[model samples]
Target: MSDVWTWPARIGVLLGAGLFLALLVPILVIQIRRYGTTSPARLLGAAALAVYGTALVAYTLLPLPSGDLAAWCAEYGYPTVQLRPGQIFADIRERTAGLPLGAVVRDISVLQGVFNVVLFVPWGILVRRYLGWGLLASAASALGASLLIEVVQATGVFGLIPCSYRLADVDDLVTNTVGGVLGALIAPWVLRWMPRAKTLAATRGEPRPVTVWRRWLGMAVDAVAYTTLSGLLAMAWGLVGYLGTGQVPPDTVPLWLFASVLSWVVVFVLPLATGTGESLGQRTVWLAVVPDVSRVADGGVGLSWSARLRRGLAGGALWGLLQVLSDAATMFDVGALASASNLASWFAAVLVVAVPFTAGKRGLSGRAAPYRLADAREGAGALSTHR
Candidate 1:
């Protein structure tokens, strides 16, 4: 079976999932929050506004200047590493000085520049919505923000990450800013591409604007609840292990307590809790319940169960185990923002891999597919139902 799917396909699957979330989360949020108040036209407009607004605010409010970012980079264990852009470029230039112009651009530095641009696409979408700005605005804001962050890092205000962080490259500024603008402009077309998502409007009662704190709380509650399920399952595992071998793995911790903490974190800190509502934990929480209702041409009631079963099975007990395994693999690999220690990577890995099934109903499988939430409203609704 594994042979049937090449590594490229497997990698594509992972990348595709990430890309989907990156593209969908913004629009889904817009539809969920704004659709209820105005026409679908206005709703989308509002969503676009919110996305860009949030991005701008995030850029401004980011704690880069606190200088703690530098110290935060190296907390991971042995074999911890940092990516030095300037050093990498210098090495590249020295090694490939004789290469053709095309080859030079194809080298590591150029490739990294391209990725830097890609990494900030979400920023563009966000900036445009937040500030009523376009691609140029988004790009300008992104460059300014990145530069601020780099300056802070160079200053070592936040700590070690700042210390080892590289040059504030002009190229990075150019690429990242352009990426942001493209994202902003791309938003409307992207939403139009989706099959029309049924949205609630003021007619049904204007959906409350989701506050940052409330959104976070909702996620927190779901995380705790899901983790509880994991705990129960863990107990079942322990009981079976005992029945079969009359022994327990000393290396293992108590399931009840561990799941409790994990679920708690899933709720409070995951990105989904903040907006996307598609964090590994949040996604599982969403799968347990059905989304909103609507009518057919004849006004027949219906349910959008397109991905529900997938969500459910993925969020199930066995799937939870797989979630943990995948997360463990993706931890260091997913977002490796290492301070000197690489603690963030380790923690992220442990959380992604072990957190779900070890204590709750959601696992790696659910996370792999995640909950297909479109906005904060749907996310909240999903959380309520998932529990």
Candidate 2:
């Protein structure tokens, strides 16, 4: 038990788990990009599978007993392979024939045999549950897994290490296969608690009309984009300053000022530059702004260059002011102001949703201007004007 639960081993497991989880981020991002949404059940299932695989791989290969390959090679010879059938059973019978029950139960070899069988049982369960494999399939998979381990041990980890340090036993293959078959046989009972595969697939809910939830999803994407863009820009700026001055760059501009500029660029200037009122969030949600039908006849359909500039400047100024205030409060350690700013931000976010019901389907910004929010008329990311 002490050998199994060492701190180094625990740390290895943790690092493996984290590595698996970190890898999932890009996979999830890809899934979201392709599907325009994610399924919680699929994500959770994939994450769980990754964790198990990582742990298994770590346990099988990490923390090599011998570090100095040359010294290990000099000391240890190639391991003898055990391929004879029933050899393990014969040994077990000879060792336990006259032993008392307690002694047999306490035997380390007996415990190890049991552990080998138990180790592959989860594989069978997972195969049946996640992959929907049948009994033969699970058993075959288990046999393959056992064969791979044996091959690795036989080849000295594919010649990466010095010599074969672990035993390659045929009994392990038999026991593992048996364990997997047994697990498959009992999968119905064991996996009863888990959601069905069909249910998991269905959890990716149908796409509805662009509502508050969809809008919120778009905003979430925008938030990610903003943070990523800001970080990249900051790094680039720092590098440029360092190259020019031959010293580490310092923040010459105040945090509030920097945040204000970033907010204007991210929220207003860039969106207007697209020649659409849709910010990144609105574009992702397939929303657009168009002149209200009632106001289009009143010279609201087309605005002069000066009017467009005023609208962009006004929107940018408001966003910049909010961003600056938030940054200032955070920098000054004003917790109350920071909290208030966060609340205010949420309130402003909800304004679009609330205004639709209260102000006749016009967003806060749209109503103030000459536009209203309109979703894509056609399916699959086609945006059309409200008019």
Candidate 3:
């Protein structure tokens, strides 16, 4: 019982909570980016799984035992195994019979029994709610999990150590399985707080709001592709400079200008070649850039090519401007001013990443221009002036 309240044990619990938060944040971002919405139930479900895993590791492996197998053999004798069932129960009964109720309740063996059952209860709830496992299946899984833990302990962590430091007890299996069953029984009441399957599938075949995450993902893909193209072009320019003047490239403004032009064409013009407005990230994440006709014309059904070109250029110019500023910021010498510039550069990067979240689905560039970014799958409906 003292071991549970020790500093090490408390740290383990804190780590488990941290793990829960760590898992939740990324999951929320991914969900918003891909689905334009998230299920709170799913996020909590994932957090529960992470906490459970952390707890499992803490109990099984933390506060490692001391002394090597050879040392133990010389001092206490060779390694041994305990295969008899009911021996723990028999010993507990014999030891507690003469003791008072308070003493019996305070015993470490009794406390361990309670801990084993409590530890596995969450597993049952998580499996039932997330994996959709039935009562019997969860119980079987609990038993299998307990068996694996016991097997590893009995084998001295599969020969890493000389002998078993922890005892492989049959009582743990019974308590853990019961805990799992108990959790499954309570899942029905707890599941009401989570999102339903229908809600999750709502955007499966419908036009969803283009989220900031989606836009950022598209930007990331485009950035990589643009950088690769820029690098090749820069190498060519450097080679030409060497051939002409027998020296390295004298000016990089041309390279930056060329890269910006290439970026604009790739982002705005190349989409025309593919016959789809989706960049690589948008394609992978099932998002598309389409014009919102209602905002484009006074009472028209679709946007003209001129409107799209203006919208594209508006967004592309800002992106190119930001890129050039970021590049220039990197060339500064190490000093207070340089640090401030770097901080501003980081702020700019953060602003770029965060703009979509604040600008709604239209994003910064689209909101600044006459075009609206929407689901590409809207097909003919996208071109109609239907708000």
Summarize candidate 2's per-residue lDDT along 208-289 as a digit string, tens digits: 3555555555555555555566566667777877899998666545433454457547755677665656666666655655
Given candidate 3, what's the lDDT at residue 29?
Answer: 50
Q: Assess candidate 3 and give its lDDT.
A: 0.63
Per-model clash counts, in order, read: 46, 0, 0
lDDT of 1 by residue, 1-387 (tens): 343223434444455445444544344444434443224454344444444444433332233333344344454211222344456467667867889988988776666666667657767754565334666666778877767655554544344334434344545556667777777778556544322334333332333433332233333334344545556766676777788898973324444334433543443334332333244433322222223222123332222243333433333322333334433334334333223125433443443453334323233333444232233344555445533
- Worst lDDT 10-window in candidate 3: 329-338
Tell me model 2's lDDT, rounded to 2 decimals.
0.62
Name the weakest run of 10 consecutive residues (lDDT summed) in model 1.
287-296
Best of the two (1, 3) by lDDT: 3
Model 3 CA deviation exceeding 4 Å by range: 5-13, 20-26, 29-36, 65-78, 196-199, 210-286, 292-360, 367-370, 376-379, 382-387
In terms of TM-score, the best-performing candidate is 3
* Residue lDDT tens for model 3, 292-382: 5546556543445665555444443345445545544443332433444354455437546555564446555566445555565566655
Q: List the residue pairs that clash in candidate 2.
A: none
Candidate 2 — worst ten consecutive residues by lDDT sum?
377-386
- Clashing residue pairs for model 3: none
